[model samples]
Target: MAEPRHTRLRRRTLVGSAAWAVPVLVTANAVPAVASSMKTDLAVDVVDPPYDLDHWRPKDEVPVYRGPRGHRIAARGSLPPSIRITNVGRLTAVDPSGSVEIIIRDYGNDRASSAPGRLKAGTTNPSVMWTDTTNQSGAKYKYTCRGELRPGQSIDIPLRYFVNPPFLHAEFNVLVAAWVEDQQEGDYDDNSLRIGHVPWISVF
Candidate 1:
């Protein structure tokens, strides 16, 4: 005898649902493995970014050191804003070979409407700053790190972020963030220690 029509329908539905669910389960299970692959022995991280300028423009112009051969590019290129970074890795960075770099972005405050790093209505308790690489204001803080950084060693990376039209007295939130793009980091987590300021002080 043929199976009842309703019973056949229910079996078919369950089979189809199980087939669809199998792929989701596999994808979910693979996430941990993929994340673990990103692990590396090299470790370094940002410590803090201090901003004392109020109603000042970050020095955007690239300047040169007055060397014997006229103005020459210093070993460490210069940009205005500087943030401190420390080597938190188990081993010191490879000398004269490995390098540490940092970039800077000013994602505006609670009022900001940008997609990646927009803050919620109120409070800055757990600030989540986003890095908008396409943003013109986003710039690499250049410095020549040419030596060994024993664990807990810190260096200030000079950075600069400027708005073309200018933000003379604008009020907004600022997230000064740095990221480890090389093998120095075990995980790809963008960390920041905000140097908090009054709402009006974030003006660029």
Candidate 2:
């Protein structure tokens, strides 16, 4: 039988200490609804990871490495699971160009470095963070990427994701932040979007 959503949320409420009422609200949703106040200049969309970019590469809004277009891609937490990017901005723009790819680099023993793991199936501990990496395809556009957000503008990035490990449980939530920036580092005018992943509950 499928685990009750409330049961799953209870676990997060306990571990995440999210909020007293948040779990009740989340449990109430038969479908997730975007929060009204959280909307920013960028439209964020979360979707299941893609299998291959061959189909995604043909989109019209696919972000090029360099263009006059400026974007802020930000996500938080270190995890090893699945997450969907949803559009939260008022802008109805879509990432037809397929220019962005999420990359996770294990920070390893270096506590000072950034943790870039994806969402996981089970177990939440030692919270970590993820900073966007510039084009994994070695493409960097030279356009004047600014932090200016117009209505209905956003970057929809699809990730090809999977978790391989000492399989014990199915998934867990990894906290993360995101931004629309030209490169992985430095200060871009755009503010980082901090989002927390709901536990990627166990499937096995």
Candidate 3:
């Protein structure tokens, strides 16, 4: 026997509805896949820069001499050093306002104990304070310095301090770093530049 006309119409309607539903479900699942593909493309475009050499300017000849224990021999280079820093805030005289920090390391990768060897802000610290590098093998030194720059104010750190280097074959580099200070306790800020190498020379 033939089926009723009403039943035939119901069957047709159900089949059409399922066909449309399949496309909608497929499209819904495809959205996440499309977003994932776009994310991967964006990640590939991100690239980090290599090292810069010009930032680490080389000196002609750095002098090597000796000062008495607990005493520092200061030497001022003829030319001043220039550095560009970022991530630092205003150059006010307040906590976290922005200041300068200088560190010296000996050729043997050890901190040198030179009395009165410090960089004084707003002026020459010790006006040529020196370090005794005499008789010290591999007696090299590196200066790691950083400063916070306030708006419209720039600080120029002259290559003024010198050490009485001990070894003639000693080699060293100077790195200038800068960053904003974190107000939180125990959490330091991230450095901006790992300046190229500043070759240390002797003026014997």
TM-score of each: 0.35, 0.24, 0.29
lDDT of 2 by residue, 1-204 (tens): 322111111111112221111111222254345433323322122232112256531112211111112232122122212322222234332221111233322222212113233322221111212223344332121111223333333322322223333222222222222234221122222222222222222222
Tens digits of per-residue lDDT for model 1, 7-55: 1011121111211111112132667665445322222233332322573
Ranking of models by lDDT = 1, 3, 2
Identify the runs in model 2 with alpha carbons over 4 angstroms from their true place: 1-152, 169-171, 182-189, 192-204
Pick out the ten consecutive residues of candidate 1 with the lowest summed lDDT.
5-14
The numbered model that scores best in TM-score is 1
User: Can you write out model 3's per-residue Cα lDDT over 1-204, one digit (the tens) per residue?
Assistant: 311111101112111121111111113365766433321000000011123247533333322223322134333221224322222322221222222333333334534424213222122322222232223322222222233223334333233334433423233333223333333222222223221222333433
Order of candidates by TM-score, top first? 1, 3, 2
Q: Which regions of candidate 1 fall more than 4 Å away from where they truly are?
A: 1-81, 95-109, 113-144, 158-169, 182-190, 193-204
Task: Give the Cα lDDT of each candidate.
Answer: 0.30, 0.25, 0.27
- Tell me which of candidates 1 and 3 scores higher on lDDT: 1
Distance (Å) between predicted and true CA of 165, model 3? Answer: 4.2
Q: Give the candidate number with the greatest lDDT.
A: 1
Question: What is the Cα-based TM-score of model 1?
Answer: 0.35
